[model samples]
Target: MTPGLPMPVPAPGLPARVRIHEVGARDGLQNEQTVIPTEIKAEFVRRLAAAGLDTVEATSFVHPKWVPQLADAERLFPAVRDLAPEVRLPVLVPNERGLDRALTLGADRIAVFGSATESFAKANLNRTVDEALATFAPVVARAKEAGAHVRGYLSMCFGDPWEGPVPVPQVVRVCRALLDQGCDELSLGDTIGVATPGHVTALLTALNEAGVPTDVLGVHFHDTYGQALANTLAALQHGVTTVDASTGGLGGCPYAKSATGNLATEDLVWMLRGLGIETGVDLERLTATSVWMAERLGRPSPSRTVRALSASLGSPDSLDSHKE
Candidate 1:
């Protein structure tokens, strides 16, 4: 038995398929009050992979002091590191030491987090925007040297709480700097969840004008103002194929209290399926994973799709086949 799917209606000017960059394990759970067990995190990764997420960002290699929730990065990566070769399990690395730890664990898919604005850079990394980029330079270099694919994450690209509306040129400059530093691709983060469709298009246009091809760009939006999916569609219209999301709508930035959860993977899948934009995700299987995770987290999932399916299907037993 499967959950209901939207009627497929092909959209013009969109990619035939999009690579959903699942960030639930790292970005989703980082702000939780309680720490999720290592085994549970591993199981989540397994379930997501089984549900057909090609790239599941596994965990972060930052100091435990900064994010105690994912302190088990050392333990968690190994547990899920042996997933199918086609499945890409990327991990976030904060600096050279973090990169060292990830490389030691055979994590070839690495992402370095940065900020497009000075305020967020200071608040999140305690460095200016330039300082943060400078810090990431060596990490990106070493990872690339080791034949690892590097993704650069620039947060607060659309808007910043302290700085207000971020200029398009400012974001374009930082994006170029990251690519120039040898990043394989870039994910523009609407960290505070304030971006609208116009702002999203503007950034993509500016980046393209700056020579950052749409193919090397990914969009990471939050649903704070109910604009994540809209912003995603704008990026899609611009020819971006990599979209970042968390399962079950499970996370928010610990630094930006106003920031809500990452774009829910289940929600993204539903829209993609409806638009006839393939994402290779099994919505029922993905929803089951969310249900299972919700039970573990002791809270109901915030994803509209997950909630609806779980309510209509009304049986956890039915979702078991998809669970890992």
Candidate 2:
């Protein structure tokens, strides 16, 4: 057994493997007020891929006016795209124009962000819920026609700041619409991080009962209330195989004021490794990657696993050269 890794406990009823959909590059950096250089962002994607995170969200094609941080999507995409086929580098496409931009850049995995409530729709996309769905419809269709894997992200699945706890049925409706619109899978977002274990299970049950298959669902939890891992355990219990995480808990909802950092990838890997679930992630290397990133951002990593491992390893002297 590795020094920092856990003993293999092999939890029963959990899947033998879970795919960690890494979002540290795009979703992680999108909300940054300080614009990181395009090369640095590209290098971040490369380092993440080198750390054994096979599915990394590279960047978004959302207009620069909306998200200045990701305005370099075109340059960043090409820089890390060669890692694709081996690594699934998914990009966020905001609308048809965004889709066109991504398609031209050879982005084979594309994601569309949607809101489960009206207020967020207005705030984020400047449209109503249905209007946002309608906009995504053509993008999904075109992506499918282009032989791309489409992931639909439904935000505010648990609770909304302006509208309190959201109904499961409302989320299910939007999820069904996205799937119907040709999304290969759906990622349910706990945007406000207000979900408990019971709420997590209940919503998964509701979506399943509404004819959504478990195999095609993913969970994206925020750690605002420190319930992310607990909520993730609930998700895993429900047979969810796809988990979205940001390295070092690097992101938040820029549009949603009350939202916080995403569930940290290093933390998730530690917990999953303890359970003996195969994620094909190297905890040591991933921790180093996080530490390097933390230094680049001039702060300590928020991920407990990263902090613990860094301390145990006596501060990774270098993250400058990530092994290929």
Clash pairs of candidate 2?
none
Candidate 2 lDDT by residue in tens digits, 1-324: 127578889878998899999998988888778889998888888888888888999999999999999988888888888864689999999999999999999999999999999989999889999999999989999999999999999999999989999998999999999999999999999998899999999999998899999999999999988899999999999999999999888885444442447999999998998999999888888888888777777667767777677877778533233333
Q: Positional deviation of 156 in candidate 1, in angstroms?
A: 0.2
Shift of residue 67 alpha carbon in model 1, Å: 0.6
TM-score of every candidate relative to the true structure? 0.94, 0.94
> What are the RMSD figures for all models against the true structure?
4.1, 4.4
Error of 1 at 305 (Å): 0.8
Which digits, one per residue and each the tens of the lDDT, describe model 1 over residues 1-324? 455689999988899999999999899999888988999999999999999999999999999999999999999999999989999999999999999999999999999999999999999999999999999889999999999999999999989999999999999999999999999999999988899988888889888888989999999998887789988988898899999999988896454443446898998999999999988899999999999998898777777788778766674522333433
In angstroms, give how far residue 108 of model 2 lies from its true place: 0.7
TM-score of 2: 0.94
